[model samples]
Target: MKTIEIKCDGCGADITSTGNCFDYRLALVVETRAVQGPSVTAMAVSLPLDHDHHLCGINCLDQWRDRKRHEAKLWSDWNQQWKEEHATKDPSGRILAWQSPPREILDARRPEFEAAALAAFPMKVTK
Candidate 1:
């Protein structure tokens, strides 16, 4: 079997020094420009733990999530600017092609996306 080394994303504790095990894992869905088509493709990918998402314990996970939530507004602003600059629009004003940002940037905007989703389709509560 192949072995890889990893550390605790939050505290930078050497996770592999003792053994090849970890407390948590997270993956973010990211989009990419399709090679053969005008459509974009999305997939769940694992990025470096120390990047945007973190792994180790519940506390670290919570911290990472809180950070992402706090940056939602910033991400929204950047996303609008990015789209305006990079998107290729048709004559009818529909976007024909677009290059997506990295996973970390997209992951950091989860709160804004979730809020938009909720607004589009409000979930009904039942007892």
Candidate 2:
């Protein structure tokens, strides 16, 4: 039989033979650019990508999963609040105007997202 070594993505703990290792994959798409005026277009500038995480045990996996779930919930709440507060309707009550969260708000969450992704892997600094 071929032997393989599995290491925890969070703490870098060896999990080979433990049968407790959990593997998770995150599929993500990043928008690179937006164009306005004339054509007025947004494009999917990134190819599909997948991030894989292996956890040594349930605790690590649970932590990672919980963090992601919390972020998703927060985003959902924010979207709902924004829609309720800013949506505008015409005389016919047809929705006419709405806006997404400001760029600053979206930018602010970027680091948090990056941190969460990084937490699933060993940290290394390259010069």
Candidate 3:
């Protein structure tokens, strides 16, 4: 017999699915594009007991959703601000932009976004 430990992504709680039957799995596909290059898409599927984004239960799932929403809003705010500040405008106020802010800048702040979201919705032990 072998033993493996899995942790929930939302709450970082240990998930013991050996005898439990209410575990939930979520499949996600992420697409990433560079500021001026081709895009890359990746798919992830939750396995039997192994998944990158695992949740202990419904509460954790809710928390995860909240965090994701917050993070998305942050990104949206950044983009909107950047566009307003950097977009080139003609006499008629017609704005033109070339994917402002650049990918490198966004990538550098990825950790900050994650941290802010986590801080707003800290993980809790669900055991």
Candidate 4:
């Protein structure tokens, strides 16, 4: 079987997805507060199909499917750890700490990501 060659989206750097594909098949989990309480969810994972690194887009669905259970278990385990680490005296013992990211993370990072968006919408918005 022939190996797949992927490239970086920004620098066009080549990425080799050979025997260590699992290493790249990572799941990014984001923690947040919900009506039920705290919740952890998958953000993205690597796709099994070949993709050019020159176009590495984050797809939480594709990446987490392979390890959905593992990711859930990880979140459960992490929740337990968080509780233990931040046990309070009041007794409610709830983390009550996780918060959503500020718009600044997107605002600051939007500039970096705008390149891709602009590329996709070329000729529509010229600067």
Task: Order candidates by lDDT, high to low.
Answer: 3, 2, 1, 4
How much is the lDDT of residue 110 in candidate 2?
66
The C-alpha stretches of model 3 lying farther than 4 A from their native spots are 1-5, 16-51, 92-94
Clashes counted in candidate 4 amount to: 4
lDDT of each: 0.56, 0.59, 0.73, 0.42
- Which candidate gets the maximum TM-score versus the true structure? 3
Residue lDDT tens for model 3, 36-116? 657744468334332356676677778888988999899999888888788888888778764567789988989999999
lDDT of 4 at 52: 22
Instruction: Name the lDDT of candidate 4.
Output: 0.42
TM-scores, each model vs. reference: 0.33, 0.41, 0.65, 0.23
lDDT assessment of candidate 2: 0.59
Error of 3 at 121 (Å): 0.6
Residue pairs with colliding backbones in model 2 are none
What TM value does model 3 have? 0.65
lDDT of 2 by residue, 8-104 (tens): 5445566454346654432223444655568754366444434556664566666555656665666677677777788897888667889887899
Minimum summed lDDT over a 10-residue window in model 4 is located at 118-127
lDDT of 4 by residue, 19-44 (tens): 64554532233434354647755569
* Model 1 TM-score on a 0 to 1 scale: 0.33
* Model 2 misplaced regions, further than 4 Å: 1-50, 90-96, 110-127
Prediction RMSDs, each to the true structure:
12.8, 11.8, 8.6, 17.0
